[model samples]
Target: MRLISRLNPAEGVGDFWAYIRRPQPYRWPILGLSMLMTGTLLFWVLQERYYLPPERPQVTYITTFAPGRTDEEIIASNIANEARKDALAAEQAERDEIRREIYRTFGRAAGMDVEKIEREAAAERAREEAAEKARREALIGESIAEPAE
Candidate 1:
């Protein structure tokens, strides 16, 4: 279009420079605000790149099955895997408990009410567990109900 062809970078640049040169009472404040906005925008845009950790690669668990495997062998393998997972989970929980006890000991020595904090944490965990149980029960009830004809 003729309108688009008439637009020139030289004219825009000159106008911008003219505006910047023109003295106004609020010019400094406006410039400060603009700089602040630019800095904030740059920070917001680059935060994940600089502040946060890099993304982790996806984990893949490979299970190789032979050409012909017996049902008992498969079942035993599954049971063993489940038992191993459970043991690892239990070990992790124990380690966490031990760490918490150490922290509580240090906190008490520092005159902090670790016992009160522990009690509050325990109550919150109980509430979360109860909620999870309710949700599980609701899902189970839905699955058990017969479909209407």
Candidate 2:
């Protein structure tokens, strides 16, 4: 009641309804500020960086060769390199076998024929297409004559 009395009715009969009907001085500036803040907030949120975990850690190696290497050392190093090559080839073969076994296991679990699936399915697809073509031709075939005019 004290607050209501303090409001000036003398200021152009500025009652509650009139005050509400009147244009707000700060409306557009407040709206613009609010929109700018929201836009900046959304921009910051959408453009934020996200780091993903790597599948494997990066590996780096630094190698140096001696200038005064002997013949015996060179021959031993060559033999070691040859042994490393054979080990690498064996590792690759074992990895391939393991991959095939994994695929076979999964295929069996899924009730799928892993080995014969690709080749036999291709053959079956070709047969099915030929059968469908023959069926369509038989329905609208040269062998079947048109009705008499």
Candidate 3:
């Protein structure tokens, strides 16, 4: 019973209310400082957890060259680099295709028109590309047009 009385939040709130009701010279300042501190802490936590952009993985390109390397060796190295890059691109394409297939399977399972969705996406891409091409041509024409003298 003693422990429960001591630990009761209502009693604690009553005591706090009595203390706050008493005359105090620094009460306003204390309240303001506490509010500011609380706001700063809340903002810091929210910014750290939600507002900050996620860090992306860095891409590092590695290349090797030496003064003593012959022309043939340099050419072979260039060819190997190109082949590796092409292989990576092909692997990425395969992964993308597999991912699309999985998405299509899920969409079909959910009774979605997967083919219609794909066609719409393709049409959207085409429209965007056309708009971009038109914008580029307009800019080029403006640049090439003779200025009014």
- The true-structure Cα RMSD of candidate 3 reads 19.2
| lDDT for model 2 | 0.83
- Candidate 3 per-residue C-alpha lDDT over 1-149 given as tens digits, one digit per residue, 9 for 90 to 100: 99887788998899999998999999889989999999999998887444768789898876566768999998999999999999999999999999999999999999999999999999999999999978986877645375735
Question: Residue by residue across 1-149, what tens digits does model 2's lDDT show?
Answer: 89986775776565655665669998668779989999999998899687998679688766576768899999999999999999999999999889978988999999997879767867999999999988987797754465534
C-alpha local distance difference test of each model? 0.89, 0.83, 0.91
Which candidate has the highest lDDT of all? 3
Which residue window of length 10 is worst by lDDT in model 3?
140-149
Order by TM-score, highest first: 1, 3, 2
Specify the poorest-scoring 10-residue window by lDDT in model 2.
140-149
Residue 76 C-alpha lDDT in model 3? 97
lDDT tens digits, residue span 1-149, model 1 = 88876886888999988998898889889999999999999999888644677789899877588848999999999999999999999999999999998999999999999989989989999999999978987877644375734
Q: Would you give me the overall lDDT of model 3? A: 0.91
The clash count for each model shown is 0, 0, 0
List candidate 1 segments past 4 Å from native: 1-63, 135-149
How far residue 132's Cα lies from its native spot in candidate 3, in Å, is 3.4
